[model samples]
Target chain A: MSAKMSAATYPLSGPAKVEINEVAPRDGLQIEPFIVPTEGKVAFVNALARCGFARIEATSFTSARAIPALADAEAVMHQVERVAGVGLTVLVPNLRGLERALSCRPDEVNLVMSSSETHNRANLRMTREQSQAQLLAMIAEAGKAGVPVNVSLSTVFGCPFEGDVSEAEVMRLAKAFADAGAAGITLCDTTGMAYPNQVAALCETFQRALPKTGLTIHLHNTRGMGLANAIAAWQTGVTRFDAAAGGLGGCPYAPGASGNVSTEELVHMFASMGVDTGVELGALLDVVAGVSDLVQRDVSSQLLRAGPRLRTHQPPAWMEEFFAKA
Target chain B: MSAKMSAATYPLSGPAKVEINEVAPRDGLQIEPFIVPTEGKVAFVNALARCGFARIEATSFTSARAIPALADAEAVMHQVERVAGVGLTVLVPNLRGLERALSCRPDEVNLVMSSSETHNRANLRMTREQSQAQLLAMIAEAGKAGVPVNVSLSTVFGCPFEGDVSEAEVMRLAKAFADAGAAGITLCDTTGMAYPNQVAALCETFQRALPKTGLTIHLHNTRGMGLANAIAAWQTGVTRFDAAAGGLGGCPYAPGASGNVSTEELVHMFASMGVDTGVELGALLDVVAGVSDLVQRDVSSQLLRAGPRLRTHQPPAWMEEFFAKA
Candidate 1:
């Protein structure tokens, strides 16, 4: 017998505190075709706020003409009742969008830019430097307004158009965000191009480079590795993550890219492993159901289909009879 | 500014060798309502054999009446042309099934029972003790017949009828299987009830008690933790795994339990991490397509749906023109 396996619980060893940021309202709904009405979006965010998520990306304040799905972001954000612990973060494109989002008085405003120049051009309709310059200004302006800033560096792992991205480039952008009065940074696997190894290596770099700044990972499950990569990231000491209600969200630009990692699934995995996410699984399930109703389509969540692991079934009649006789 | 992030590439770390045992022929088809033809089953097994799978569970020698889906197990076993590198194993329920499987001269015969008594009765229609005694006899008989025996302990993590199986109970069954001269013992998450922590714990116990014996994991993606759990198991130093092509298995007894971990997806994950599974992803994808044809339905494969992560899309017209203009 090998001595390495002497202990029973070694491999499942992971960090204790994992804060999940619900991004259903921002990344999740931004791409949905059927516009989730303002009231319904507000209700959903309010419901999620109660489900023990410490952070929620409420909605993106992009141009209404661009992402029509989240056109009512101001109304949705202003309408939702803020919970004491939940930090409502709204996505903004530039200075103009920041002004509109600040009016809603979200707890934080998140800025976006792509690590890939081509991706930045396609997603934000500007070059990477142009978006960065504008975002640096937004950060400075938001800082003046006393609103915390978060930067989501998209396509850090790989881009849909340009293929593999360099780690140095991602760090460069992350360093820029950290230096520009940004409170937090999110490394976005924009189209599920992240592998576990890449996630770990990147996270190690992030932790070493900017240990004091808050870090979050936003992953998509297009290639079915959202949770797996998230686990890898968590192992490297990343405590915050971006998850969608019922695995909502897909890239409107990147073809075949699917939903973000399911919030309930992440909560389920962490809870199962004895890690604390402070989520109420039963209440989270209700929010998932509500999201499903709001979308009127099947959500890409495995937990939604198969309930919690301990959910038992009554033994078959034959087995019951045989056991009863026994 | 850490040296780790200074490198352009990092993160894809894994064990050099990962053994993948394809189980679609047995576990994948056992629950199908429509019976795959005997010839198709043979060809599918033969096809999987060529796809760099070192092991394949060819069929189950259970009573034809008990599982009509695999009633042609004998015919399928006889027709598959034995390949040099592939070890074609067969599943057996009891001494009678072992006898039937031995007649076909399989490379290995896997004995079956459940960790939970009720699951054993429901699955094998016998008490755990009775099944263990019968399996011990089968092991002795198969040993004398110069055939190897592999025992699969089903529902070692959690049982549908009896939830939260104790680690001690699982270790007891694994120890029994090891003592009975079984060549390998597979820990079966028959109903997708096994979480990563439980997998890690049981695997540690198994390695401690039977370190030299062959160990394999049979995981289902029922709750979507299949891949996440697989990563956990890998971290614990267990490499051999049982995966179904196209994720083609389901538990008949455990209703709503979904398919096994998709073999191609596993291959993809390992390969992306620079680990060697010896299986060609493109060839495996074709095999997945063929299995989908045989089953006549869409199987739960993320790779089949989204393609590989590096599979680049032709940048959309707008993005291409934008970049061209830039």
Candidate 2:
């Protein structure tokens, strides 16, 4: 018998402490067609906040004409009560958006800058370098204003126009964010083009290049690898993650790109592995259901529909009994 | 900086030789509602044989009335062009099934015994011990007939009636199968109850107890852990896997448990990790489409819907014109 197989508990040679950032209210609601009512957004945020998520992306302060779904960002933010330990965050596109977000006084402001030049122009109407500099200036401004900044390095995974993104380019953007006093950096697989090998390699490189900055991963399951990429990032010691309730959010520009990583699914994956993410499974499901209701569409979360994998218990009937009995 | 983060490639510190057992002909077809023509089965098996699969579960020698899906097993086996290195296998239910399988002269025979006592009684009208003894007898008979035998421990993950299964009970069944001279043991998530943690724990236990015995995993994505469980098993040195092309096969008892782990998705997962499993991606997709035609339903495989995530080359129209002119 192999000596490694003799151990009772499979010891993974990696760090613990995984943190999931709920992006449903922001990323999820942004793409939905029918506007989720301000009250529904508040209820959704509050419900997810109770799930022990340390950070939740609450809303996006963008042009009302652009992302009409989240136009009532301030009203939603005002109505939702933040949990004690949870950080309520809102996305800010520029200094004006950041100023509007500061009025809501969210715990953190997420500033997004596309890594690809074409994506930057499409998403923000700025060059990649100009957007990076703008993001850095915003981070400096946020730091002075006592708001932690999480810079989302979008299109780092791949871009719609630019087929293959270089590792050096991603590292360069990550270093820029790190040097700008950004509280954390998130690599958004905006186009869902990352393979596991690429994710592992780039995450390792990013971690080494910016050791002090906290790294978060935002993945899309468009190609059915959201969970796999999350595992790869987890193996590389990335703690923070961006996921949507019921796997919401798809890129409008990227054809066939699907939803973000399902939050219920992510929680289920980590909690089953004996890693503590401090999220309640049942509560998270309630949030998924609420969000699904708010959006008026079938959310693409397998766990939400199929239920958790329990070794013993007949589901459907058993689930009704379990919940009723509870 | 963490030492693990600086390296380009972390050497996966366990077993590397991956064994993929193609069960498309048997497990893939057995659950289909439509009857696949005998020649179609033969052609499918021959195509899979050329894919360098180490073991191919070809047919199940059972009463046509019991499983009408595999009624033409004998004719399919008689027509398939046997490859030199691949092991052609069939499933045997009882002594009569074993007799029929031996007549076809398969390279190996697989006997399925459920760990759930209720499932054991439901699947085979005998008690757990009686089934074990009958399997032992079949193993003895197969050894005399000069054919190898493999055992699939079904419902090892969970049972509908029994809700949760214990690691100890599964290990006991594996020991019995190994002691009976079965060439290998397959852990089946019959009801999709095996999560990745349980998979890791059981695989580590199986590898330790049966060092020389082959270990294979047959998973259904009923609860969405199919891919995650595969990765967990891979990390624990489990190489052999069973997947259906286009994610076909489901249990009649477990309603909504329709998809198996898609062969194309598994191929993508392994290939992306730089693990070579000699199935050609393009050819596999073609076979999936062919089988989908034979079965008359779109089997759920995302990669079949979305092509491989290779880098796209999007040259500017002017650049393209310039190159075209040149």
Candidate 2 lDDT by residue in tens digits, B1-326: 01122122353323334667877788879988888889888888888777777778898998999899898888988899989988898999999999998999899999988887877765665678988999999999999998988999988887766767788899998998898788889999876767666787788888889988989999887666677678767777787899877777776655345567777777776765667677777788778777767887766567766666663535343544543454
Question: Interface Cα RMSD for candidate 1?
Answer: 2.3
What docking grade does candidate 1 earn? medium
Off by over 4 Å in 2: A1-9, A13-16, A160-164, A311-326, B1-17, B311-326
Q: On residues B135-239, what C-alpha lDDT tens digit does candidate 1 reach at each position?
A: 999999999999988899889888988898888888888888788799899998988887777786777778778887888999988877787778767766677
Number of clashing pairs per prediction, in order: 1, 5
Which residue pairs come into collision in candidate 2?
A: A311-B163, A311-B164, A312-B163, A312-B164, A313-B163
Candidate 1 chain B, run of 10 with poorest lDDT: B1-10
True contacts kept of 2: 0.32
Score residue B215 of candidate 2 by CA lDDT. 90
TM for candidate 2 is: 0.90
